[model samples]
Target: MKYDWILFDADETLFHFDAFKGIQLMFSRKGVDFTQADYNQYQEVNKPLWVAYQNGKIDAHELKHSRFLQWAEKLGTTTMELNSAFLNAMADICTLLPGARDLIDSLSERAKLGIITNGFEELQDVRLEKTGLKKFFEQVIISEQVGVAKPDKKIFDYALGKMNYPCKSRVLMVGDTLQSDIVGGINFGIETCWLNRHNAEKEEGLEPTYIVSSLVELKKILIP
Candidate 1:
């Protein structure tokens, strides 16, 4: 391996983050049929909250509770309860991406692994335990605990501290999002690989150290 440590992003990078499916599961338990239209309606509120969270304009608690406020009011439950239910639903449905296990297993033999995510603490722990991937990681940094999200250098600083301050040149961050993972790693003075599975357009004024369309492709790059 070219790096001493390989840090990952949790959702949509290593694991499948099927928010629509999770929301459907959550609402079915409450006797509501969550349709595509309902999901679209939900994302109208949820998507901006995530952007705000990433930009450091909002905290995790606000993002969590605010997204489900309308549904919580309609269902006569607290936003916190709805958020917990949503996280739990996501956990129960969690599955590693197609090549995630093989990639992680291969990398673990050569480099230490860690996760630095903006995902909630509740889902991260449960899903890692359920997937039996917890033992492979030396550090799992959640923004909910760190008081900052990625794209802010503070979270990367916190992760580097937990990683015992490894030489920056020997660290690589891998994630699916360009704004958070690639930009954050670059700004923090480490290499980064962008997992551009959907062939999304590259953002202006940003370039990743490497780019791969799939984990299988990424595996070939690192393990070749």
Candidate 2:
């Protein structure tokens, strides 16, 4: 077999997270009474929290709660209300990217499929369940659930451990982020496939074994 297990990233790779950004902005404006400045501030604060979460310096609940608290303080609002609004907004708008379902369906018959995401377990579960994409994956490993995130190598090892497959060479890591997916896969000694949806220029020191503009292209590389 060309590949045994196909591991995937959730957000931006399979899910259209950019589509939810506008919804988040709308929620901040209406539900949280947030200004443009406050919205920008929240993103600034949230990014680092995710990095810390990935680094294992903090846990999922702490990261989410702390991000909300930080944003609430910046906006002079209650953290409880902001957190509620955030969760509601996320739940309302979370959706899969174009061709995500079709691609998964096509690949499942040919290769064992799984999700390896650096996201909160509950939230990722909710998104996958709501989007109807959860059924395709034989296994789902979230960083929060495993206590390790991408780019650290340990998380990839954990996923492989769960897979219990003898052929390490017959595994591929597919995701949108170069920093996380490519780096982590390289560390794990698996092939990496980059879902370059944005056509962004590659940065220095990060590389993938394969690059495709769409999930539809996956069948060409994997099945052919």
Candidate 3:
């Protein structure tokens, strides 16, 4: 392998972060039927918050609590409680993306592994542990813990510190998001692999060092 370290973004990149599925599980616990339309409504509030979150306009706590505020009011619960329940529900329903196991297993042997995500700390650890993926990552850095989100470079600096300041070129960031993960790594002067699974149109001025449609393709590059 050419790299000594490989850092991944957790949600959508390595794990299946089906927020709709998580919401369904959450509402079922309260005996409410969370329908597809309900989920669509939730995303109306949730998706923009995430965009704001990754762009550093909003904090993680605000994103979590604000998105569930309407539901919390309906369920007669605190936003904190609702957010916790949502994280728990998400953890319950979480699973690794296909080839995540094989990619991590193969890379962990040849390179040190880490996770630097804008995801909440509450769900990240639980989901990783629940999915049996925690052991493979030597460091798991959450933006909430660092008080800064991805694409900001401060979070990347924090992660680099945790990684003992490895040579920038020898570390590779693998993530699904173009704005946060790819650009952040690019700004930090490290190689990045954009996991463009859905074949999204590439944006201008944000080219990653490499692009792949799947982790299987990534495995070939790193392990070949």
Candidate 4:
């Protein structure tokens, strides 16, 4: 293996993070029927909050609470209550992406594995454990605990420190987001692999060391 360790983004890259389904499940427990319109409304509020979060303009708590504030007030619950329920719902539905387990297992033999996610603390651990994929990683770094989100170098610095500061070139960052995962890894002076499964438009000026449509393809690159 060329790299000492491989770090991954949790949601979308390793697992299917169905936020809309999670919200629907959460509301079902509350005896409310969450509809397509409801999901659209939720995204209208939630998307920009995430952008603010990635830009470091807001902290995780603010991002978590603010997105659910409207629903919290409408349901007579606290933002914390709504947000926690949402995360629990997400955990209940979490599933690994196709080839995630195979890819992780194969790479684990050649490189130490880790996760660096901008996802909240509530869902990260539970999902990993429930999916039976928790044993593969040495570190699971959540931005909420680190006080810095991805695309910022501090979180990567913290991750490298946890890995005892291995050579940057020997660390591979694999994630789906162009800005946080690709740009952040580039800025941090490490190699990156973009898991562009949907063939999404490449963002201007951001380049990844490798791009693959699926983990199966990535497996070929790393383990072939």
Number of the top lDDT candidate = 1
Which has the better lDDT: candidate 3, or candidate 4?
4
**Of the pair 2 and 3, which is ahead by TM-score?**
3
Instruction: Please state every model's RMSD to the true fold in angstroms.
Output: 0.7, 2.6, 1.0, 0.7
Candidate 1 lDDT by residue in tens digits, 109-133: 9999999999999899899899989
Candidate 3 segments exceeding 4 Å error: none
Error of 1 at 181 (Å): 0.7
For residue 197, model 2's alpha carbon misses the true position, in angstroms, by 1.1
Q: Give candidate 2's error at residue 13 in angstroms.
A: 0.4
Q: For candidate 2, which ten residues in a row score worst on lDDT?
A: 18-27
The residue ranges of model 4 lying beyond 4 angstroms of the native Cα positions read: none
Candidate 1: segments with Cα more than 4 A from true spot: none
Model 2 spans > 4 angstroms off: 19-30, 73-81
- In candidate 3, where is summed lDDT lowest over 10 consecutive residues? 125-134
TM for candidate 3 is: 0.97
Q: Give the per-residue lDDT digits (tens) of candidate 4, residues 1-224.
A: 88999999999999999888888999999999999999999899899998999999999989988998999889899999998888999999989999999999899888999999999998888988898889999999999999999999999999999999999989999999998999999999999999999999998788899999999999999998
What pairs collide in candidate 4?
none
lDDT of 1 at 94: 94
TM-score of each: 0.98, 0.87, 0.97, 0.98
